[model samples]
Target: MTVPANVAAALPQYDLGAEIGRGGMGVVYAAVHRPLGRAVAVKRLPGVPASDERMSARFAHEARLLARLDHPHIVPVYDYVQDRGEHLLVMEKLDGGTVWSKFTGSGVTPAWSCAFGLAMLSGLHAAHEAGVLHLDVKPKNLLFTAGGVLKVADFGISQVVSEGATLGTHGGQVLGTPAYLSPEQALGNPLSPAADVYGAATVLYELLSGRLPFDGGGGALAMIQRHVHHQPRPLVEVPEPLARVIMRGIERDPRARYRNAETFAVDLAGAAAGVFGRDWLLRLGAPIHLSPQVAAATTRPTATPPVVRETLDIPVRATLAEAGTTPVRLGAETLVPAARVLAPPAPARWFALAAALAAAAMIAVPLATPGRDLPVHSADLSKPVTLGLGDPTTAHLTLTAAGITLADVPATAPDPADPNPAAAGPTSPLTFELPGASRWIVGGAAVATVTADGKSADYSLQPVTHPLVSIMGAGSAVLLLFALAYLESVLRSVRRRRAGTGAVVVAAPLGFGLGVAVWLLASVLLRHAPDLWPALVCGALGAAAAVCTVVAARRSALR
Candidate 1:
């Protein structure tokens, strides 16, 4: 098919600099929008179609569908026009290539593939919510941006399969790429959101495994037949959880598959997060029922009852493989155990216990002989300690109190430029002074072999508290004020509903008023009482007002 003359002329607005891509339906050009000062993609529809009316209508419908959708992961429709009687769509041009390109080459990592799937699901969910079905969803329609954002593009072949649309199937008019088409779509059954779910799964499978589920040298018809009847090979090469999710998504029966893109997204996310498990159903609070097949798979063989052992107090369920040829013996009767056995204490716990023991030994050994004092040493503080206002950095020092006079406690150099260094230091024979010390205590060394007569104790230093009530109080006040305003708006909405007013008309002003009030209060507080104290006062006032309003509203509702 030749490009339409008018479409060619309209392409200049987009600055169609170079022809970049071509497909069965149209050619995509690298274009620049002069006024917007940004590069864009221009897709020009086929000028002449063998089936003129149907194809043109479909193209126009797709453009309209793209215009209605506004989502981050979807290619934004910038402009659409017919110049010289030819159709063209100007869209956000992505620098990175298509998913197909990546898959056929050095395939993306599993993390990237998962991210791509999520982006596609998010875009598809938005489109589905807006009552549009992307009839053509394949790797070619998914684009990667230079900034690493994934976008779903090519809505030109999308069908408005929402409520109040035409309901007949176009026989022998399969719309999507054959390898990714759902069984229902391949059979020419009426399309629904599940079809998209199936296609998304196929794309995800291809991304992880680097191969399509079905391919044929014969023709499109052969591929469609395989999609309808044949079960694709299990994606065993991919991670188990991901493979399971894809298999479930591409289930032959539409009813057995995810009901919508949102469900698919949730399942895919679970798989990617490594949370996919049989217990997920239990976690979701779903009813537990074993199908006959599962029940049979788990059934244990009947054998002579084993003798009970005294040491084994609990009956342990063992797998068939672990059961071995001999019947395993159980212990004497005991209380039914909890559903889940508690895991053994972790290595961290053992390490913590050892640390505690060491600490206890350090303390107990030195104090066992109270009169014989230990020498303590100070920490090296020559290196600058980095700390925030409320944060503290501590250093340990040890000195022997046995030889040193009680009055000759080790003196610490004052923090330069700070007059209140005494407040930060310790005030005892064993503990020395350090500026900005919240608390200080002398403790024995972790090793106990050293004698207490000259062994020094370690001291831990922390930051002193600097109270600033106004900041915290003010924040609370602002939050309380907003809460009150939100409540007022909600009450107004309920009143309007009760009075038989439409939701939109009543909600608009209430919502606007609430938002404006919040902004105004926030701005006032920020400008005047930037400190904690003033903010605290405001918070108290807001809370009081909110409580009063609630009381008044309750009285009004009662009346």
Candidate 2:
């Protein structure tokens, strides 16, 4: 927290106090303007020495950029200082601390999270419109005002996107927090507004779910790889509509993500209204500021109908015997305000039921279909026992007093173009001698059971497809297709910006699809007709994944 003597000595007009924070950019110190008696945060650019011309240019660029961004949610710069070998940026001091410091994984409510997002996004959109991208939009950069209004800070690593030029990266390395970097940003590709959108979405995700979208277990490199190649584990406990918005914002492909921060903010406001209520913003009671566009979004008709039932006026018939109050009630009786009931519209209710049924079917089909076992056929090994009846047989099993011998047969015919067709085959068949073995597995399944005498064996032929396994396999294919359809639906629905959807739309079907695939593969390999447990496992995974995805999405979406 200590500043260099020269840095303190350079700023004679202000009193530099203790260090507030430090990062790769520079160290920030609390200060007070002597003349104005105004508190401010002075960031000393020790990393950018006055001797380094390129660094100095970048420092000057940051000052100019910060000065231009005069929005309410962005930290406003007061002065830039360059004296001797030291460079510094002075800005308004926000004493309420940062989101990371106070609310990392705090599991804040949806309305609160969305309100924070609105303020952050409003500022980001303003910056974006001015051709600046805050590449490092992480929780730490989100500082709250004393009134609890969130403001975006630290444009040190921000890039100014102008005509065909970008300002941030140096030496092929992008500067930003790895956990929140967009896929393209992680890959050092040219960035767009979508990158900031991705970062902001990640911040909101953390605020709601109390976790980063990608874990930084393996360090920055691993996180970057995950950002580029992996989908965010679906949010848990988050509402589907809000989750969809976040998902779209953090999509791997920039083209697939939200176009700008303002658009994202509007969608978030709309989603907040659907999940919490039309007066969600009013109810939030958090002193977060909202731009006009975002505030307008709250009144827009949500894609989904209101989830909670409208307040109903029910008439109460008061009887002289039942009423504890005075029995003077007469005429139309009393119409009183009952307890507020929360129920979805009838159509929404039915749709939820249908989704539940579909998810159940996905799990049930795999468990219910008990595949038929392959019949054990006795084979006399005295004569060569062919394993498969085909033009080119699977293998030959020979049981002798010495041991059991299995020889592979060529699966392909000799090339007619070869001058020596006979020589094209292997000099000797590939053979394996299993000494004193009572069972043999082929192609990942136990296909043959040998007798103790070793002269005869009970063998299930290779490629013996069980009708049930085939059915399950075929069903798996269907589930896969269905999952694809669901994914498409997710994308389409997100584009339409609908709200009030449960987690089933995206997470449930996708999980069911994965379960179907696992069940089919495991069932086919195990080949035990009665052991249908794999189906149950499949179902369990599907259910658990649905729950996990739902939970994750829910917590992340609306909290």
Candidate 3:
């Protein structure tokens, strides 16, 4: 197909620098927004048959969908315009390439693959929450920026779910990439969130292993059949945690997969947190199977040891049998020839000196010293309290206490003076302030103990004091200073090792010392100032630490 002249004219405004990518649906160009001084990606959809109104409508629908989606991990659609019977969608131009490119070429690392998968899952979850589904989700649609932010792009085949609206049916459409299609989508069933979940898993699998789960020379139909009938090869080589997550995600039955993108993200997060085996399976609400593969993976032979099972732990035993050999069951306590052994901690006597010193410190420290009690007294109800309920009809409360204070109270209270006080019971635990006292008083304490009739039965309120909270805050500052110093020393050593002894190492010590000084100054201010000044001081110190660390790291990297 020849490039339309009118489309060519619209391209100049975008300062069409070069054609970056092209697909059956559209042609993406690298363009410069000259006036705004920024680069952008301009995707222009070519004119299709006017007879096929369904295709035209779907294309327009995609433009609308892209406009509505505004998320950090989603490619932002800047402007959508039509020129010369062609539609153009301008988007934020990212310098880095697509996940597809990485998957096909030098495969991404496990950490990066997991990270990218998690980010894409987050974006998909956001779209799902907004009642939109990217019908076609694949590696090609995932992009990476120069700053390492992963973005989901190309919502060309997305479907918007609205109240009382049926699924897209024009031209008998079955929209999705075949390799990543959910079983329902492959079978041309009405779509749901599970479709996206399946597609995401396929993309994740590709990202991790640089290969698709199913591939055949028999073409798209064959691949679809495989998706519908055949089980995917178990992701045994991949990390067990990730493998388990992917397996669940690509389950043959849509119902067996994650219910939604959010749930999938939660499982992915668990996998990333290194939870595996039966424990992780239980967390995922899946049944556990003691498979031979699992046993082999967990067990390894060592020269110096015969394996011994830990107390209350189950040991998996297996033996290679000859063609006619009979199987035998071994007792739980029976030690096999080549079993792996686990050991318990050494006796407490080994650390006797350390324990004695710790005991001495505990004894020397004063448990408690009599200090002025920060009295928390209840309201003096003897006087005309004149409690005013904000909404009297709703039975709102107005507590007028003297010395007692309420922490973490709701903003509005129900009307306590309501004729129908039953409504207030639900919205009880209201908090109010004293007329001239410094402390805030809480209402509805009686409701917690008894009903409005005030009969104490089974309720308890304990006073919580954190005298060590401030002390810990101070200790944190000191630890931070020491950490910085230690980090500087490590960096210095690293530089000396890598670039030789004479290499310049100036920023580390300087940054660490400056951080320590700022922390000390902030601590002093915190001790002197009243109110929430301590919190502010801590925040300032934290910000300073972050800035210093970043700057120092950048400088060191440059060196």
Clashes of each: 24, 16, 11
Ten contiguous residues with the weakest lDDT in model 1: 442-451
* C-alpha RMSD of each candidate structure in angstroms: 26.7, 18.0, 29.9
Candidate with top TM-score is 2
lDDT by candidate, in order shown: 0.53, 0.63, 0.53
* Residue 547's lDDT in candidate 2: 46
28-58: candidate 1 lDDT, tens digit per residue: 7777877778998788776564147777776
C-alpha lDDT (0 to 100) for residue 109 of candidate 1: 53
User: Which candidate model has the greater lDDT, 2 or 3?
Assistant: 2
Which rank order by TM-score, best down to worst?
2, 3, 1
C-alpha lDDT of candidate 1 relative to the true structure: 0.53
Question: By the TM-score metric, which is better: model 1 or model 2?
Answer: 2
Task: Give the C-alpha miss distance for residue 484 in model 1, angstroms.
Answer: 86
Q: lDDT per residue, candidate 3, 1-559, as tens digits?
A: 3445665686666566667777546788877887898899888775552235666666777687778887778889888876556788889998888876665444455545656676787788778777788877898889878876778887766776553223343334345666888787776666778888999998887655444677533445667789999999766435566678898999989889999876776667556445233232334331112223332322322123222312212222212222333533333122221211111123323334333443233222212212122223334322222232232233322221112232222224445587866546543443333233212122212111222222222222211222123332344456656655754664554332222222223433433344333433333322211123333333344334433333333344323
RMSD from true fold, candidate 3: 29.9
Which segments of model 2 are wrong by more than 4 Å?
Answer: 48-50, 105-107, 163-173, 306-559
- Lowest lDDT 10-mer window, candidate 3? 335-344
Model 3, position 321, has a per-residue lDDT of 22
Decoy 3 TM-score against native: 0.47
